[model samples]
Target: MNPSHPATASRHTATKTILFVVLAVALLVSVLVSAGTGQLGIPPQEVLGSLLHRVGIDWLPLPTHPTGDQTLWAIRFPRVAMAALVGAGLAVAGLIMQAIFGNPLAEPGVIGISSGAAVGAGLAIVFGLTVFGEWTTAVFAFVAGLAATLIVYAMSRAEGKTEVVTLVLTGIAVNAIAGAAIALLTFLGDTQSREQIVFWQLGSLAGSRWSQVLIVAPVIAIGLIVAYAVARKLDLLSLGERNARHLGVNVEALRIGMIFIVALLTGAAVAFAGIIAFVGLVIPHLMRMILGPAHLPLVTASALGGALLLTLADLGARTIVPMADMPIGMLTALVGGPFFFWLLRRTRKRAGGWG
Candidate 1:
């Protein structure tokens, strides 16, 4: 078989299509399972029925258990949906950041955006700020996240271009400042507020509400759409800047647009769920490894992979302790930390020394 033959290309395309279908099915299954796993133990069938009923598909039989519909609709479904949104958003944001920086290790949480949002959330919690009433924390978090990204970009830009090393270093400095701000807020807060700050930092979807989901979903959906529209440009960008420019990509504009989208997606995710880590870093990298570096498939695969990961992680968070909800962030960090170490070691070996 000729490796470059048209038949070989067709077969490869067929394989990728099948992989995408499998991943989509897995994500759907994860959602159903996650929605069914709370204290009441709603079966997947009942969960599906409840969802169908809510969407006006009244032909399907309703849940037999008296409280099943209410529990699924009012509680479990919202949490599961939010988890999917946050997971997808974070993963896609990570993919964009990595593309923009041309580094596999780039991630929102690692690059100070999550910390910046955390600082804003801390302020809202400690000071009892109610500028946006119930959404004060979310608004503050979103704005602060964008602010941090802008600061990083401005600091990193030089001679009409943004260097990858400069951006990474700026992220490190911004993260340190954001961390210090959060710590100071924690110190000044009352016991209740301090606890709230701590728990929020650790990240959980415990209080996931339909209202919050409503706000987060649209933002993430829009960001994902924008990302997909530019997927080809991102692929061109993976080539060096000069080559990309020669190919007619407006490199500076693409970077700025991607940065903005990353801010919007990452901010929305953090605002609702706090700082869940590793979904972004791990999912995209894994997807890239399996599907190759084509941004379109990589982005789609990363979204599904992230959604599946978080839904499963949330299930583990709820069920692992048998009655207590564990911190979702802790679980992701536990998984991601080792993976991160391995990634660093591999990259170092590949480069033959740290840059």
Candidate 2:
């Protein structure tokens, strides 16, 4: 018997709409608030005026100094925007990967896509491949991530069906191999290249620019829409492969499409921001805990929550010490690692009937 009834469906829909609105407002406030923060400590009114001035609000007085105005317009805005985009993209990618593989534990980091992107970025740094303008590293990173996902998909396929456990195991193996490849690349890199590679590995949004935001924003938007479009199908997919196929879903096609989109989003995020882990794993699971397993709500909640979490984390990264910017990745891992272990313990307890 289906657990979903008409009342439950209506309630779920209502909850989702409310969550979306709340998150939308929250995101707007976060953007404005985060923009005003940093070492310079621009006043909120000034931040608003500068932002409005940029968009043709001539009546409002602008920041008189070029340095302050440029700091807000050029430096802070792009970093916050990139952080939001990367967080949303990685979270959605994780949701898609989990749905496609039918494993709650599956994530871009777990399956090696982030590592692949890092390798791609490292290769570009080491070799100076600049055929594609400023996007040389990004393009290669996307390609490598896509390739890694496809290889894992192929390896996990057996007798024309995907085994979720096998897929996860395949990811572990691929991730290890990708890790080695990255290490090897680092070993062979020159000192200058090695420093660049180290920074990329550690992950920071401190130097993000408008150009990087422009490159990543569109792709992530497209990927998010595609993922949401299939949200209902992903809900059905949670039932079982046989059940999903019986319900008129194209299982194989769905899996492949999800892998592709997730790879694109994950690769683009890693390209611009480097490998930040557990946003995907932690946020989606938190959403699930609060809102249940409906994909529509889950995806939107994950996006908003992930964006908020990363923005806050980035803020901490910048302000945690005076004049010392810590790696954003380190901050995320510091929090996400313990959370993940707690989740594992909780799962084990529940499974053992001790919850």
Candidate 3:
């Protein structure tokens, strides 16, 4: 089977197109279902109609239940939107990190951004820092996340060169330090603050609002665009640093740009949604398995896949236990932990040993 053959290329393109369409539809369905499920239980058709009505399409009749419109618009829709944005942002960030580091296992959290955000959130909780009013914790988390990424980048540089191994090691050290800081805050805080800190760590979309959706949507949109623009370079970088450079890719610039984009996307996501894990780590790998290593399709597929995974997780979170809003992060961890172990085992098997 010659990959360069016209029929082979055509088949690959057709497969990718079909997969993309399927994923896009799945994401749409997930969003509709997630928006409809809860204690209130609006039907999926009404949910879609409400969405259309909100956007000025008045053809679909509204739900007769008075609060249906309110619940769908003010609460459920925003929550679902946040899930989609955060999921897409994290997935793209993970894909970028994995490509830059040349490691299938790399994720957005590999650089300690999420840990840094958690530490900042801890500080806000413990000290009662509401300088930004309602947004104080989120602001702190976003700033801290960027700060951690910059520190890791600085530490990885030597004589105008950045090594992937050095970067990853620096991230490990930073994450440990951030974790210690969070622990210290936890130890010093009062009971109420302690509980707040725990909830932030666990991650949830419970209080999602349209305002948050507006803020995060643009950032994720911009990050995805930037990521897609550099997708080809990322694909080349995976071949090896020297090989990428030989092919005229500016490895350092590309690395730095990707690092910034990853930080922006991950920071915004964590700021709003807290520390949802596994979306970043799992979605990109799953998409790559289905879509192969092409970054263009990989990035798109990851966004849709992440959105689908989180939407469904949120649905389960709300419904799995009656009258309980389960932490969305816990659900993802439950699914992703087993998947991670399987991935590790598979990688080892392919390499024939740990080395």
Please provide TM-scores, in order, for all candidate models, with all chains considered together. Answer: 0.93, 0.89, 0.90
User: For candidate 3, lDDT tens digit of each residue in 143-192?
Assistant: 78878888877887766545655766787898899978988898999999
Question: In model 3, where do residues sit more than 4 Å from their true spots?
Answer: 1-4, 130-136, 150-174
What lDDT score belongs to each candidate, Candidate 1 first? 0.87, 0.84, 0.85
Per-residue alpha-carbon lDDT of candidate 2 for residues 79-187, written as tens digits (9 for 90 to 100): 9999999999999998888788765667788777888888898899899899898989988898899899888878877786666557667878987888888888889
- Superposed model 2: Cα runs more than 4 Å off: 1-14, 56-66, 155-169, 348-355
Q: Which 10 consecutive residues of model 3 have the lowest summed lDDT?
A: 159-168
> Candidate 2: TM-score?
0.89
Q: For each of the candidates, give the backbone clash count.
A: 0, 0, 0
Best by lDDT: 1
Prediction 2 global C-alpha lDDT:
0.84
Query: Of 1 and 3, which scores higher on TM-score?
Result: 1
lDDT of 3: 0.85
Better of 2 and 3 by TM-score: 3
